[model samples]
Target: MNLNLRHAVISNVSGNNQGQLQDTIVDAIQSGEEKMLPGLGVLFEVIWQNADDQDKQEMLATLEQGLKK
Candidate 1:
């Protein structure tokens, strides 16, 4: 079977409003389930791809700071 998880994740969240998207992210993180990682990664990929250079740099800096803790 051929499966495209990233595509599936994006499609599942398509058309969601900002509040809905935030709820999805919050729920996934709060659940602490390993299975949610792939969905988060896919969402991150979408954000990274759409972010500008400054936003990407800020995101990287924030990620670095988080990793240090």
Candidate 2:
């Protein structure tokens, strides 16, 4: 059985509002379970695909700062 994780993840969260999305992200991070990583990556991919250049630059800068910590 071939599964497309990105599609599945997007479908699962398709109708979520900003608050629900925030809860999902915060819950995943707080859980710190390896299994949640794929879902988080899929969410990040969705954000990256839709982000403009400035948003992407801000995200990259935030990530760079995070890596230093």
Candidate 3:
């Protein structure tokens, strides 16, 4: 999706707390809930977009690792 939409989803998931968003996203991922994937993708896009170079690299690396499992 577009960046704006991605940010909006992240903002919604964040619900006024940046820290909680990460945990929520991770929980969704670990839970293996197919319904949550789209929303998670939006959040991931937002995180990928806003993350610094090193963070983006690490995030992508982690995602790649997850997909291998």
Candidate whose TM-score is highest = 1
Q: Could you give candidate 3's per-residue lDDT for residues 1-69 as a string of tens digits?
A: 567866767667655575687688778889998877888778666667889999988987998999999
Quantify all predictions' global Cα lDDT against the true fold: 0.93, 0.91, 0.77
Model 2: per-residue lDDT, tens digit, 21-64?
Answer: 99999999999999899999989988999999999999999999
Tell me the alpha-carbon RMSD of every candidate.
Answer: 2.0, 2.1, 3.2
Candidates sorted on lDDT, descending:
1, 2, 3
Q: Candidate 3 — which pairs collide?
A: none
Q: 8-35, model 1: which lDDT tens digit per residue?
A: 9989999999999999999999999999
Query: Could you estimate the TM-score for every candidate?
Result: 0.93, 0.92, 0.58
Candidate 2 Cα misplacement greater than 4 A, ranges: 1-3
lDDT of 2: 0.91
lDDT for 24 (candidate 3): 80
Global CA lDDT of candidate 1, please? 0.93
Off by over 4 Å in 3: 1-8, 67-69
Between candidates 1 and 2, which one is better according to lDDT? 1
